[model samples]
Target: MKVILLERIGKHGHIGDEVSVKDGFARNFLLPTGRALRATEANRKRFERDKDDIEKRNQERREAAAGIASGLNGKTVVIIRQAGETGQLYGSVSSRDVADALIAEGFSVSRSQVDLANPIKNVGVHAVPLHLHAEVAVSINVNVARSEDEAARQAAGEDLTAINYDDEANEAFAAEQQAATADLDTSEE
Candidate 1:
């Protein structure tokens, strides 16, 4: 189905551009979201008549998004979750969780704006993109960790996923082996 876009959609046609999309996509998402209208003769004429108004609204939205993006870009949000020793989270972190964390940090954000391709499954810092507007995009850091201290360590560039053995234990084992070697030598003598 062909539709006249009211605003610039990612990879779709710009404002007032007629483009063909899937029928269900047009009916369920584009039309319901008011991002587009069906490309009928009557709708085309109406779009032309009100094109200026639509562009003005789009510009205002873009400007507002730009303002917010300036403040939100590169900001970090901390998320606490339980994880195993290898740093794999018990449960993954979804976009909703990131959005909620941003909201709690006094930012106006929604799950739809978060562009996380997949749920986060590891304990570390992740760069999550956000589509604030059609043209206004920004990224933020999500510090996922088992505790506040772990988050801080991740922020400080520590990789917690690696299996780290205690240095003291290694030293103690080496000392025990040397003593056993000496005992064996004395018995042979």
Candidate 2:
């Protein structure tokens, strides 16, 4: 059957697209779910009006996504995990982790938007691509670092503080402060 999509059925198709599908499938799924309508003259005209509105809304969304992409460009996100001596992670970093990192950084992004082919296994810097829109993709830096403090605490069998993996600069600064304090204590002898 020929139908005009009222909403996007999948990732690619837009609203008001004339697509061919089986009548039974359309009746059972698409029509009932309000994903499409029969391509009659009245519905076609209605679709024409709705198309403009949909396009305008999509444009606004694209613009907002672009702005977010701009803000995220060249920004580094850190994820600290337990690793072996060779830097192999105990567990890999998944899209959900990346999404959570982005969310913590004040960006509202979904896991589905992340385009990672496989979970990160080794610790280092990785370029992660985020698919904000169909044509809009932006690459963000992800640094997976070994949780040194966590590892030390675990080795000594002490209670480990929950390490914040979102900020690399803060962690670096904290290390520097600790070193400075240690130096002052040694010099005060």
For TM-score, the strongest prediction is 1
RMSD (CA, Å), each prediction: 2.4, 12.7
TM-score of 2: 0.62
| Residue lDDT tens for model 2, 83-136 | 776667899999999999999999978998998999999776778999886657
- lDDT values, one for every candidate: 0.95, 0.80
Q: Write the per-residue lDDT of candidate 1 for residues 50-113, one digit (tens) a residue.
A: 9999999999999999998999999999999999999999999999999999999888988999
Off by over 4 Å in 2: 1-16, 19-43, 148-189
Error of 2 at 156 (Å): 29
Worst 10 residues of 1 by lDDT: 162-171
Lowest-sum lDDT 10-residue window in model 2: 153-162
Error of 2 at 187 (Å): 48
